[model samples]
Structure formats: C-alpha cells, structure tokens
Target: MTDTIEFASYIVERLKQTGVKQVFGVPGDYNLEFLDYIEKDPVLNWVGNANELNAAYAADGYARIKGGLAVLVTTFGVGELSALCGVAGSLSERLPVLHIVGAPSTRMQRSRALLHHTLNTPSSFTAFTDMSKQLSCSMALLNQVSPDTPNGYVDAFDETLRQCLTQCRPGYVELPMDAVRAVVSTRGLNVPLPDSHAAPSLEALRQLTPPGTPSPINKLYKDFGFFEPKPDEVTEHVVKIITRLYEGAQRPIVLVDACAARFGMGPIIRHLVEACGIRFFTTPMGKGILDEHHPLYGGCYAGRNSLQPVRDEVEASDFVLYVGSLKSDFNSGSFSVHIDDAHAVKLHSYTTQVGYAEFPTTDIRHVLPLLVGALEGVKSERPRVLGESLEQKMKQGRVATLVNRPEGTDIVHKWLWPRVGSWFHDNDIIVTETGTSSFGLLPVPLPSHASYNAQVLWGSIGWSVGATLGAALAAEEEPDKRRTVLFVGDGSLQLTVQEIGTMVRRGLHPYLFVLNNDGYEIERQIHGATAQYNNIQMYDHQLLLPFLAGKNPATPFESHVVRTQDELHALLLDDKFNVPDRIRLIEVVMPRGDAPEPLLLQARLTAEANSGH
Candidate 1:
C-alpha cells in the first residue's frame, strides 16, 4: 500500500527537499491554511513580511544568494497582485522564485461565487492566473481534491518546479483552499526531485567500456566524474570559428557580465581568466562576479564613462570575447559602446555568437569550459597594459584628498563611495540601490571574495531594503558569516522601508547606509534639476528605527545621523559601530545636486538620445 500525506504537507516537503529553509510572505485569510503547514513543518519557517511586495523582493534577494529557488506564499488575487511588481523584477533578472497563491476552493469557483479578494464578477476566477502567465515560466493550478487525481496534481507541480529550475525564472502555483488538506500519495517524496540535466556522457561511457575493461570512461565513471555534455555539431563549428579569431588576434580581452552570476558561471570564468592570463574587465552590472584583486583585473568598462585607460584597452582590442554579457543602455553608457560586431564573440546563457555566425542552444556554461580547455596550450601575445589597477590608484588616497575640505562640508559623491570602499572587508556582501549608489560603486575597489548585488537591469529603486533582509539571512547561513551592507537612497527607502522591521524581527544585523540626498538626485541629473516632483518628504531616519523595533524586540539596534564630513569620518572609525553585533543604520546627509560621475555622464547621454540629438 502507498503511504499518504496532506497535499499542503507534500508541498512543504518538496520545498524543503529543494533547500528552501524559510517561506516569506504575509498571512491572509485565503493562505492561512497553507501558512499553518509552513509554520508546523519542523524544517521550514514562515518569514512574515511587512507587505506582500517586500516579501516578494525578499524572495528575489534570497534566490540571488542561495543559488536556488526561493519560495513566497501569498493569498489569492489581492496579495498576489500586490506582489506582482517584485515578481516581474525577478522575471526580468532571470531569478527563480516560486510564487504560491492560496486560491479559493474549486466548489466556490464552480458556483461562480463573488469572493472578497476577487473582482466580484462571476467569471473573475482565472483573472489573476491569466495575468501571471506573462511573468511566469510555468504555472500549476491544483483545484482537484479527489484522491484518484493525485498523480495529475503531482505531475503538474513537478513540471512547474522543473521549468523554474531549468529556465531560472519565476513559476506560479495556485492551490485551492479545499485541497490544502486533501490526501495525496507520499510516494513521490521517496524519489529525489530531478535537480539538473542528466549527464549526457553516461550512455556513451557505458557503450565505449566493456564490462571487464579498465578504460578511461570507466575510471571517470567510477570516480563520479562529470563533464558538461558536448555541444552539437553546429555549436562545435561556431566554437572553431571563435578559436581561429581568438588565436589569430594580437590583443584579445575578456569582458565579463551579470549573466556569469545568473547562470553560475563565475568559477568557470575565473578559472579561464587565471589559466589564460588574459586581461579582463567587468561591466557595471557584472562588477563583483570576478576577483578584482587579481593583477590582470582592469577597472569597470562603461563606454565613454569608463576610465581612460580601461576604455582604450577595450576599444583597441583586435578581438573582444564577451562572456555572459548584457548590453543594456545603462550598462553600456547609453549605447555608447563602439566595438564592431565582426571583431566580437558574444556568449550568453543559451546562445553563442561569433562574428557573423550565431549558434542557438549553445549554452555558456557548456561552451566556456571547452573554450578554456582549447586555449590551454595557446598563449596570448598581448601585454597587460590596461593602465594602473584600481587598487594601486586607491592606495594614493584619491577620495581622502577630498576629505581635507572644511569640517562642515557635506559629503559629496566624489569622496563618499571610494571612502566606503576602504571600509569593506573580505567576504562582505554589498548591495547597492539603482540610483546614485549603483553608479557610485563602479569606481570603488572591492576586496577579494567580496560580492556585490544590484538590480541594474531591472532598475528597481526600493528593492535594496527588502533584498538586504533576505541577503543578510543568506550571509548568516554562510560558513564564514560575511557581513551584509546596504546602500540605498532616501527616496528609495521610503518605498519599502517597512522591511527594516522584518530584519529586526528575524535577528538579522546588517549595516544599512541611507544616502539622504534630499530627493531623487538620480532623476534630477537626467531630467529635472530643480523640479518639485523630484523631491520627497524627508523622515527623521534615526527616530524611525525605534518605531521599527517594536515592543520587546529580539535584538538591540542602533541608528545615527551624519550631516558633515567630520561626523561621517568619525562614525566610520568608531569601533563599536564598526563591529556589527546588532543592526546599525547610518543616515548620511548630502547636497541635492551631487551625483556619481558615471551617472552624470550617462544621464547627459540619455537626455541627448531622448531629444534625438
């Protein structure tokens, strides 16, 4: 006889099996039943957030650090719709997030009952699912509670989860209220969920090796050796063309981008760089994907906004190998990049383009290792002439020079970001918001093993607050327990500031840096320099912390406000504040017009483009 378990319990069990330790969302009437299963599950905890949107953002952040699916549970229409923006952001960034909606019962839907959360129309039952279809890779609606249809439900759930893993995108599942406690076979739990593609070489290895023979394939099989499956003939042919271009070039350089992190190709790309000894640079979105401390590490390259030496090296290259590259306007300094397509080899998550040839289904994760292996014997003749390393330039105290101004001078962009870089330690996870904070970090030198997080492509403003909460949780789970730091604008903070309470509630302590620049300074740079629309209501940030830390808070938190250069400098050096025993918030006040150098340049370029110049 097959064992059985509650359907909701099975869902929670599958989530735990996939390495989800916590579920983030708000409890609602529709989802309360499913929330009970989450709470009672010994292995999983329900992380209640201030709102549905913040919960979704937290899930996205968690997915980024955890390198797996992050699950969020919400009620039917109202709660799920509120969280849609965050879900769309995840979809845009290719992050895997499983959005589980506790839907109404099938009986109610069959009767065409006007649900409180629904649109109040008889035919509004599938409205939310129809809207979600655009943002999710796959979806499953489990409305059947009959015991005989358990296999169908299981198959639907399994396939949706599979699509989420394979595509690295969001998936949706709607579980009716009546089905939450319905009985389902527990036999599916006996088999582990398929995690990745089956090793393609397994069948070949068996065929090439006899039953008693000690062949290389047998040795590899015995040792559990794994090779990324070989590419198809067309892919191999494209790789050969790229090999010829790369080998024949005099000065070749590698450009790394955000897709490296998205597809978990960081280690492979790092190995390629170290083994080949080729000079490499990261785009703004791909900043922390590679070790910046390496000698061959050139500074960030962003079209004309890049440092003079970095731009010269990139534009002058005879051949450009762009691995996991994303050429967004912001990433490319408003489409200012000047490389010819004939001289560039672009590698993406699922495709590879070499000169005029394009090969579909040519995954970067598979081709990168083979490309590295091919270049093992070949050596590049290009000299490392990408100018002074960022580390070397920072040692001269470039930002410190600006710090010598009068004591009461407000902190400016020229001195702030680089100074913050000096405070970063190895193994720190820094998350920057999508305004001046993101652009300012382009020039800062990150230490070895330090990871940077940003929503560059999505350009979400208030994402950092909720993301910080999730990232801090992920960092705490790490072996070394790296520190989590956040840089967000005041305008951005106002959008999702409630997540700070969630951080405190969960006992997560991260250094939260609020850039109180008066208003939307990034927008001011682009269009409105002094428009009233750009301004936001200022909050006493230091006082807001006490309110976020509710009665009988689990952890002690501290907040401070800095108005001048002297105050900011002293706070950075304070031993008690530097040691992050509890949550700390530092609000730094700056001038209204101050913005990062790169932001100003890009804003001007964007304005010129918009005006048809």
Candidate 2:
C-alpha cells in the first residue's frame, strides 16, 4: 500500500498548480488522516471555518477570486452534507468548485451499519451531487468510475466534477480512505489552468451573421467589403453612425460589464471610454478596470435601489455604448427602465445573431473599435452636458420624492439605502441579494468608484453571501482598494451566513450589513400576508455564533443589534465598529408591515393579469 501522505501531496500539489491557494473545511473522524496531512502541508492553507457550510462558501469565494479551480475539503457524512447549501449556490452561478471529500475506508463500503451523524446509512453524501449539478454550471470528480461501486459514488462524483470543469460549472469529488492511500505518482498528472481551452477562431467568428445581415463567416473573405471601394463599405457604414451620433448626441456614455474582461478587451475599453470623454459605470462584477474616481465615472449602473442621481445620468445620455454585455437582470436594473433617451449600440460575442429590440446596431465587439478607428479623422462635437443641467435637476427631484415620506419611526426603504450609499467610496464593491432590498429603491446612487453586483438575471436569494466573498477577494487583489461590502437582508443572509467564518479565516475583511428586518420581507410584501412557513426562526442578529463555534469553542463575536434609525446613525458615526475584528449588526427596527414596493406591484400585476386585465 502506498503512503497516504503521497496521495495527499499529489492532490494538494495539483490543486496548487491549478492556482488554488486556499481550501475551506472542518475536520471529522473519517477525514482525520487527510486533515492531519493538511496540517503538515505549508503550501496548502487549510481554513478552519465554524461549520462545513461556511467552509463550502469560502471555497466559492476563493474560487471566484482565483477564477478557475477552487478546492473545499470536508469529512464524510455530516461534514459533506452540511456544505450542500453553498455548493448549490456555486451551481446556480456556474462557478467551479472542486469539493474534495474524505470517505470511510473502502473495506467498510458494504458494511450495512449506521454511523455517527449519518442518516440510517453513510450513502447520503453522494446523493447530493444529483441536486447540486442541477443548480451549478456542472459537476464531476477527478477519479475514474467503476461498476459495482455502491451508492454510485463514481458516477455521482466523477460526472459532477467533469461537467463543472468542462462546462465552466461547479463540481464535487469524494476520495475514499483507501484511494487516499493508493499509489499515484504526480509526474504524469495534467493540472489545468485558467483559459486553457482555446477561444473561438477567426473562421468561427466570420461565420456569425449580424442581425438582419446575411454576411456569414464563409462570405466574409469573399466580399472585399472593406476593400478599395468608395466610402470603404465597413468604414462608411461605421462613419455614418458616428457622424449621426456626433451631430445629435449630448451626454454620451459607455457601459461595460464582466464580458469585456472575459474577452480581454481591457485596453480597447479604456481607449473607447477615454475617447468618448463620457461617463462610464460598470456593474459590480465589472469593477476595477475603470478607476471609479475619474470624472467620467458614473458609478455602478444597477442595484442602487432608487439612487436617482445615477439613474438620471444613465437615462439622460444621448448615446449609450455597450461593450461585451449580456444584459442580465443585475446589469439591467432588475429589468427596471432607464436610458430610454439614448441610442444603444451593444457589443458581444453573439451580437450578430439576434437583433436588439432597443438599439440601432448588434454585434459591436468588432464593430466598436472599427467605428472608433474610422472616426479617427472625424472631429468629436458631442455635447458636454445636455439640456441646461436638466439631468441634474431631474435627479434631485427624484431623490426628493424618495426621501419625502410622512413621519414615522418606521425606516423607509429609500431612506435606509442612502446610509449605505453615503458610506461608500469610489473603490467599494456592493454585493446585493435578489429581494426587495435590491429592487425597491429603483435608481441606485453609488460613489463614482462604487458598483453593484448581483445575479439579477437568476434572481437567486441566497447567492449574495457566497458572491460577496468572491467579490471581497476580487477587491483585495487591487492595491489599496476599498473593502467590498455586502448589503444582505436577514432572511437571505441566513441561507449562506456560514461563509462568514470562512471570510474571517481567510482574512477577508468585507463589512457585512445584515439588514435584520426579521423575515423574507420581499415575499411578504408581494403576498401582503406573512407566509409563516417561509419565515425562518430568528437567530442572534449581532453575534456570529456560527463562527465562534469550532471543535473547541472560541469567544462569541462582539455584535451590535440596532433596532432604530438613531442607533444606526450612532453606529455609522462611531469608528470602533468600522475597525477590523468587530462586527456590528444594525437591527433597524422596521415595521413588520415593511414590504418592497416592486414585489407588491408584481404580485398585483400577476393577479390582474390572471383576471385578464
């Protein structure tokens, strides 16, 4: 039998080669040996979280930060089971997570016996993959599968991991104690790296057709479209649009998203943004590339919850330049209306295949820079600021309307948001959840450098916590960048709160604002009646008990439970709470009647539509 240490070493080394720097988990009886090996290995940093769920979430965060393969180790039975929640989150977001699990000895495979923390049998852990894959990008394992493997461990683990990696999804793996002891030399292992797969070729690109344009990939080289002809077909076409934009436009803007980064268009994006001399706002996922503090930075375009000034800027722009954007809900303000006045030119991989209902051109990824190049000789006469400061006046009017509700100690959603916005700086990233908090305050206002990130397209409630961890990691990578902040409601926070310990263990100091309004306020608002079943049992609002509890207990976290506006004001003004190692939970005692307006409107609209309204 080979030494288990070698196997551990191989796995750890391969993980490192894949750019994995941290592993999230807790020790358990079945995985004790592996944990021992981890303790001995200096290269692999094992983060001991308060629970398996948080550890799993931490892995999600690390994977997001590291951007390719992320590893999370857990023991058999309950340890593996506890992590399913976070794994489910990873699946929903299409994030890749290598869940390495330690199983009981192979000799005990068929032993029909109950074990501690197991439900009747020890096979429950493998069953989770079936559900996990449905939510994640994909799932699989590194190990080869074989028939006669009880509980279908091979199929469950291998398939899940393979799909996650190949499809750019999340995956899982369970290592039997015997397998950990098996002899496997590291010399031949093929560890993968980010973007290892080649991108689509020029041939494939040419094959793509513009919306309503019959120019297929094969026809691209056939026609000398840009050849020595008058007006240079492509150049003329680009100039006509540019000339029109220059003559008609006022307050031009460019909006970019993560797709730009994915396409390696950083330099081009910067050039276009600079050339246009218009303000730019990136989605939370698309932050960092553009310095938010720049005068032309318009702050995050989505999820400010009625931050009027930002919305006004976006809506008033005469021309909106979109680069590599997929137009997901988060980037689109949960499908809220804005930028109605501007002509939009969207750029993306599939721009040519489908026409945008709202814009003049599609498939701009290539056309954009081409347009910029063609406009090289053309003078820019785009207006500086449009309509005699009309945009600014409109923004102030909207802000006034939001904060003007009649007096009551009850905290209005609009009023609550400004506090968070007021605290923000240019470099902070805000990770939002998919409930009332994200939608109620329609027009979001952010510091020039601040941005909002959420899975608005997916609208997953529990995604914010794990996503925040990933965002924090992204923020930390930038030199001297402001810390990432999470504006999570109580109900959503509980779903993924386990990651808090993982954050602390990894030394990520993101300030988590747990808006403890006591229930799933969004659902209740829409339903107009408390769905008692949907409401979760309350937990300590301030103290993070989950992080404090370990194999050996540690002191409970010092938390503040605020219940009024006065308390929040005092807390925000206080410096101690802002300091590291201290978590203050401001419990704004909002009325149980507090409901997100959009949810209520949506429910009303649904009912009306059902009645054939």
Candidate 3:
C-alpha cells in the first residue's frame, strides 16, 4: 500500500500533475509552511514575486502560453486581496489560474480571533473567499474539517481545479495553516484528473428519439430526423446551419478572436482556414491567433480603423464566420464593424450563434471539427489571392513610408511600430501594454509561430511586465526556447517595473522595448489631448537597467535610448543589439501627441461617441 502524505505535499503533486512547473506568489507567515513544501518538491519551483499582484499576473501569463493550469500561492486577506485584480483579468480573458490562499489555522478561524492580515471583524475569515466568488469559477474554503471524512478537503480542491480547467478561468482554495501538514490518503493522486470532455450517457441517447422510433445513433444519414432532440443534437443542427451558410455564400470570410487561443482552438481554426480557401482576418483582440504569414491571411479588421481593402472585404462579405469573437469597443474599432446579423455566424467558447438564433451549451470545440469536415473541399468565389495585395500594402506602408527620412527627424508612431516589426523573429511572443503599444502593434505582421499578447478587453496597464516574466519562464521550457518580447509605454512600465528585477533574479532574458512617448499617450488620444492629468513624470530610461540589474548581475544586460528616426533605423540593423546574449531594453522616444494611424481614427470615433454624435 502507498504511504499517505501531508496535505501540502498532495496539493503540490496535484499541481505538478496539472503541468504546473512553477508556483508564483509572495511568501507570508500564513503561507510559509506551504511554501516550504513547494520549494522542497523535486518537480516544482517557487517563483517569489515582489508582490502578490505581480505574482497573480505572472501566473496568468504563464497559463496563457503553457496551455494548462497555472498555480499562484498567496497568503490570507491582504495577499489574496492584492491579487484579486489580476485574477479578475484572467477570468475576463478566459485563462486558467489556480489561486491558493494560505489562511489562518482552523482553531483561529473557529474562535474568530483577530489576525494580522484579517480585517479585524467577526466575518474577516470568509470575506476574501466571498469576494473571490465574483472573480473565480470555483472556491474551496478548507478551514473546517469533516470528522467522518478526513480526505474531504481533497475533494474540494479537486473540484476547484476541475472547474478552472473546464471553464478556462481562475479557481480559489483557502488552506488553513494547520491543514498544511494534515496527512491524507494518496489514493486520489493515483487516478489522473478528469478532462473537460464528457462522454454522452446512454440515457441522453435514448432521449434524442421518440418512443418506438429507430435509434438516432444508428441514423448517421443526412436525413436523420429527431422527434425530441437533446442538447447535443441541437448543437449539431446549429453547426450544420453554420456550415451551410459558409458553403452557400460566394464571398465568405473567417474572422478570429482571442478566445481561440484561450480555449485551445487555434490549431483547429487554422486547419479550417487552410483546408477551405477563404480569406481570413483577425480582430485586434485576435491578432496573432492566425499566422499572419499565411498567403490567404488578410490585415486586421478593427471596424473603421482597418485598411480600406480589409474593411471593404469584411463589411461587404455575403457571409462572415466570426470565431470566438470578443467584440469590445477597442477591439471592434469603437463598435464600428458594419457586418449585419443576418449575414454573420458567430461562435463563442460555450455558445454558437447562427445569425440571431442562439444555441447554449454548444461548445466551439465540438463544432469546429464538424465545420472543418463539412467545408473541406469548399471554395469561395472570392479567391484567397485577394489577400496577398492587402498584406503587401500593409508591409509596404511600413517599409516605404519611412524610407530615406532626413536625419534628426523625431520618431513618430508610424515609424516606430513597423520598425520594431522588422526585429521580430519566429517563435517570438510579443506582449503589448494596454495603451498606444496595444493599438500601435496591431498592423505589424507577426512571423510564423509568433504570438501577440494584449489585454484588450481588460485594458489593464502594467500587466505586460509581470506577464513577460511569466511568459519568458514558460518559453524557457519550450523545445525551441521562444523569446519573450514586450512593448509598453513609459507610463504603464512604472506600475509593474519591479518585475524587471524579478526577471533579472530569475535569469530570464526577455527583450523589453519601452515606448517613452512622455505619458499615457493612448489615454490622451481617447479623451485628454494636453491635459495635465494625462501626463506623468519622466524617468531616465537608460538608468532603469542599471538600477534594476543592481551590482553583480547573474546575466549580461543591455540598454539603449533612441530619439530620432535615423538612430532607430540604425539600431534595428545592428547585429549585436538584435542578437543579445542577455536581457535587452530599447527606449524609443516619440512625439507626445503622435499615435498610430488606426489609433488616431479610433480616437476620433471615440471622441464623437462620447459627445453623443
């Protein structure tokens, strides 16, 4: 018989089983015991962050790239509360994060004794978990133990993790101080955690047909009729409706969004796009979900901000297949996408919509493969070749528009992003902050196998710094050792700049590019042009590395500042800087008011919207 282990050890082993190599968090008195177990584990590493918020962001970022559950360990009350914002972002973006909070001992909780991190009220113990319910898919409070069932806490932990994986959102668990060492039977660890896929029950199959009718299972024919179809049958019918819409339309197009990656549907969607010769486009939130290098890949479609040809093709399409679309204002170019509901078929993570008809419980995972099979040999009258010129136009505008610029000319938004694009290599994960950097990098064509990370819906500034640290760690584990590239405005960088020190301490070498455009440039575009409230204090960008790196760094580091177009162009061509042996930071300065062309158009639309136009 196998020996029982401490509850903390069981939790660590379970996390490792879920593919979590690192646990990101801040150590506290409440969590110290749990941290010891995590650190001593052979398979798991403890990544100590400067703060709990950064730890949460790192965990979320790690989950985004690793494609499995990411674990974050924080202490009770203060620590868990600090990490709530990050957890909320993960929930909004559909990323799976397991947030484990170390709480006071069971005795302390039952006695209602005041604790240092507690709110000093009778309800203090349960306050965090109650608040967490709003941001997490599941929550487990393990303060009370069942006398009859010693292993009851394990069931709660298992269910919380299961919900996190199945929902692709955050989950919470509060482990009391004493329970950390509570021994539990290791029997549960013998069997692997169940996946999201559930087999159809025999009872469900019987419900699909009327009494005395032939089994619907046997009727795989095209004309199979149902007397009373179950949920699965209705989902299949919706899929067929979408398939027919695509097959019948002359000028059909596929639009992808961020949920494709969040729900692990990128490969399936790519297969559908490639197998059917249809023009493909991505919303700003969906950027990098599809390979921009694909011959049939068109430019990004952000409503009015899209290129003329891309806008024309998408808006004028006879039918549109929008997969995992999160039509937020910024993503849809201030809600300006002109596709009519009658002509579009939308697919979400858990729901599918054929025009105005909505089908709940119809997962994109089940429908995509069927859609791909139905449209394998189907060809649209609008050839995929139409996308080539549009792609070329995007590239030409970047390359030709800035060529032969005079010396001493100030760097503008137009020249900066495209210039940065030339430096991107394959297997690079590009993370952008929520301001100008987000909108600026939209048109830059990502290389094959590259990913563009942005918090478009969350719109949280300073998320990229911690996220980059997490992504770099995740990438280091990959076979090819993908590079993590970050683009953040000076204002956003100030919020989570301490993570740079964490990256240095961890020996991660992400290429950090800070856009030093004075302050809050994206916000300035949306509302305030020259308002003092929109501005922030400037810092010596070059000094950031030296200060963050400190003395006797583990790895080599490089930092540079470029103010003019010629200097920026020359830096991109420099091999030594391009192929750095360590962490590299490039601060590209641009005019205060200048922003990306698309961003400027979006700003105008946003301004008009606010004025009741």
Candidate 4:
C-alpha cells in the first residue's frame, strides 16, 4: 500500500517535479475525473480557461515565462482537437509543454462503442490520437490493452516528459478515464527522471509513417536539426574560425533571435556581448534578452522593415554573429534579410554555421563560451557601430511624435508605442497580438529584464489575450512581483476575448492595452485598405472590465478609453494605474489608416511576394 498511489495523484506528482505551479484547462466530461485531482492539489492551481484553445495558449505562455514544463489538460476528441492549433504554435516555437488528454475509458474504446465525441465510427477512435501525433515530437496513448512496463503508467509518464524536455517542444499523453483511477507503483515517482531515456522515441515514431516512405525524422533533423556537444577539437576549431572573422571585420555585430531564450542560453549570450564588447541587435523574437540601455546595444533588426537607423547600420556591417535565428517571414521582414551565409556566422543550439560550412554536433552551449573567451582580450577598432545610438534616436523620435501633439488629438501608433515603452517598468512581461500591437511595439526598446511574449512567428490572432493570462499567473509565482501587460488590437482581441473572464476569476492583474483602430489594421495595410472585410463591429470597451470581472470581487478593476493624447498621457502617469494590483484595461483610440513603420514595410513586402513580383 505504501508503494502505490492513485493514477491521477501520480501524474500530479510528476508535474510537481517540473516546478509548474498551475495547470491550465477546460474541464470536460472525460477530463472531469482528472480535474478533481488538479483542483485538490495544494501546489498546482487549476486555471480554468474560457475554452480549450485559450488553455493551450496559456500553457504555452506559462512555459515560456516559467522556463519549465507546462501541462495542459483536455478531454477526448473535440476538446483536444480545439486545443491543437495552440499546441501546434507551442511545438513550432519549441516551447516545452505536456498536453495531457483525458481520453475515453479502456472498456468503451476497446468495445468499439460509438462515443459521444467520436465521429460515429469504430475506426474513428484513433483518429484524434493520429491527428495529434503529427503535432507532437512524442506521444503515448495509454490504455489497459497497451503494452505495460514494469512500472506501467509511471514509466510512460516519465518517458513522455523526458521526450518533451529533450526535444524542447510539445509532447502528448492520453490517460483513459478509468485509468485515472488505476493503481500504479510509487517506485517510478521516487526515482527522478533521467537526463535522457533509454527508450528510442524516433524508432517508435518511424513506425507511424508510411511503410515504404523515408523517415520524417531525418527530414525534421534536416530542417530544425538536433542539439548536442561534439568532440573538443571540433568546438575549438569553430571557435577559432569565429574569433578570426571577428578580428578581421571592421564592424562586427551580433544578431540574436528567439532560440537563445528557448534553449536557456540567454545568459551566456549576454555574457558574450559584455565580455567581448561587441555591439548587438535583436530580432523581434530576440528582444528583452539583453539590457536595452547597455552601451553596446543596437536597435531591433528586422531586415528592411526595421527602424531606418537599425536597417542602415545592420546592412552596413561586414560581419554578423547570428545566434539562435528562426528567420520566419514575419520575423525576418518577409524574407528580406540581406546577410548571406558567407558574411554571417550562426550559432544555434544544435549546430554552428560558419560561412557556407555547417557543423552538425557542435552545440552553441559549448562553442559560445569559448568564442567569448577567445575574443575577450582582442581590441576592436570600432566598439560602437552606429553614428547615433539607437536609444538616443528613440528619444528624439519620441519628442518629434508626442511633444507637439494637441491634447485632443488622436493617439497614432508612432506616438503610442514609444509612450508605452517609456512607461514600462523593469522585469515586466509584455505580450502583444499578431496585428498592430506586435509591429507597433517592435521599434521601441523594452526596459531591462522585461520579458517579451509575442506570437510573432506563429502570428496567431487573439493569442496575446490568452498568453497574458498565463504570463500573469507565471509572474505571480516569481519572487519579485513582475507586472504583466498585454497589447492586442480591437479585432484580434475579439477572437479569444472571453479569456478576460478567466483572468478576472483568477484575480490576475494584467494591463490590457487594447488598440482601438476599428478592425484588422495589419490586414488593411496588406491588401484591403478600405474594404469592408477590414472593418469590425465596435465594442464599448470601457464596460469590458466591469462585465468580465464578476460582481463584488476581491480586488477591483479599472477600465478607461482614451480618445486623445492628453487622456493617454494622464492615465499612464497615474500612480494608481502603474500599480500591479488590480487588472487594468486601456482602449487607446487611434487613426484607422495609421500603422507602425515595420508593419507597413512588411505588408508591402508580403503583397509583393503574393503578387509574384
């Protein structure tokens, strides 16, 4: 009896090891049994999202912020399917999340019964599992008939989590409703999960592919590659090559991207910039990793779609040390980056690319430190790459945009984001939606230690609203009270706006900055400038707070709409508004035609690409 526990308790215990403080989900019939365990757990809080999709996104945001495992629970078939798109985003962005799906009972599944959630066919039992398999690096659909290990569910659970960690992406597990109550050995729980598992996940995954087809794993490795250390000599050789190139170039700069943070290598990268005294810039994905006020800091780089000063300086540089770059179209300004393979040295978690040559096994963790040490003493002729510092230029631009504007004038994107930038406190979590909110925030720099959480690569609308909830919850777990903030457009917010209710119920305090430009401003910039498709029905946003926050809550919420410059300026300066206590919503009114410079540039580039020009 001492050696066993309830199946649901076992899973919760596994989660406790990952240091995840909360589990996000929408309770359905299949998952109701599991929810009982989640609700009762003292360590892990159950954050009931408005829907399955938002829960998945919340899980993603939580993992990204917490830098640990994120667990998302859902019911069978329909519930899990609804959450897949959000899970897919996490998978694509290499966020570690375990999608625990409470599935049908073993008896029901094996009997080939027409389940309520099924497609009315016996063969449809495996359909959802099959569909989900494509989205996850590894998955285990456990049942009574499933092959059992010595420890059964415990071993399977550990193995599944191990895959999620090693792959640094999403993984899936299925727990039958009856299996949630199954007795399992306590032996597996006592033994901590290993650094790597003995079981071969790729070999098992290969079986799911077509019989004669080549392994998809190989193709995946070709694309995303793998992260591992190599022989001492290979790493030394790569470091020497980078050091040589750095010494030779008149103007050398570092271009950082999202994977540095994803792989937890930001500290070493930051150390490299400081120790080597190299000027550095960040892609939208890479922002907030380094201190923006650092002397060697350059502006955010996004090919041609960057601030004019940033674009000019980056393009002029003879050498670029690209670290953890994920050059998707949106992140890379519609594939407009001019830095070629010959001029750039890329350091990835998996591999290092020097010129046109690539080393498959030299891990960035091993190589980055050595390169930093090698270049630490070297004297760079040009430490400061740009004529005018990006920070100073931002100040100048702020004056030009906001200084002379009338009190009653509408707040445009140019004036809005910079003002928002100046208002941010250190160590805040800033989440932006895929529309103008994301683009508008790019040109301005964030405060030191601020965490930027934009779904730029995935470009999922309404993502920020759900992500904000997760970020806020994750922040609550931090020793320091890190303020959470969200900037989502009026149109994008409508997609998953119900998440506000979840935020209210949880008593999470996030600053929700809704950019009210009428509709999809980014879409308007892309093609339909004045078309009806770009328009959206307006919401009385000031009432959004009271309606969403339920009656007579523990903490009060503040909501305001600012149509003019003075209104926004006054609200931002208010001490009550700055406190991270109550949830706040600010609907800042702006011009319908106005957009951030980066968005305008990318939209034009996207249109050209679509037109086959």
Provide the lDDT at 231 for model 1: 42
Model 1 regions lying over 4 Å from their true place = 144-147, 190-231, 379-388, 393-408
lDDT (Cα, tens digit) per residue for candidate 4, span 297-413: 888888878877788779888889998899988888888888867789998644678999876445666677678789886777764443455677756763224344434478987
Per-candidate TM equals 0.91, 0.68, 0.92, 0.91
lDDT of 2: 0.57
**Model 1 agreement with the true structure over 279-370: per-residue lDDT tens digits:** 78899988988889777787789898787767887899888889878788888988888787998999875567888866555666667777
lDDT per model vs. reference: 0.81, 0.57, 0.81, 0.81
Q: Model 2: what TM-score?
A: 0.68
- Name model 2 segments beyond 4 Å from true: 1-7, 26-37, 50-53, 64-69, 74-85, 101-168, 172-192, 195-253, 257-270, 278-410, 440-442, 448-451, 458-484, 496-510, 534-557, 595-613
List per-candidate RMSD values in Å. 7.2, 7.8, 5.2, 4.5
Model 3 misplaced stretches (Cα beyond 4 Å) = 1-3, 144-147, 194-228, 377-389, 395-408
Which 10 residues in a row give candidate 3 its minimum summed lDDT? Answer: 196-205
Q: What TM-score does prediction 4 earn?
A: 0.91
Candidate 2 lowest-lDDT run of ten: 352-361
lDDT tens digits, residue span 311-391, model 3: 887898888888888898888988999999997988775567788876655666667777888888565565555457345
Better of 1 and 2 by TM-score: 1
Name the TM-score of candidate 1: 0.91
Candidates 2 and 3 compared: the better one by lDDT is: 3
Count clashes in each candidate, considering only residues at least 3 apart in sequence or on different chains.
0, 29, 0, 0
What TM-score quantifies how close candidate 3 is to the native fold? Answer: 0.92
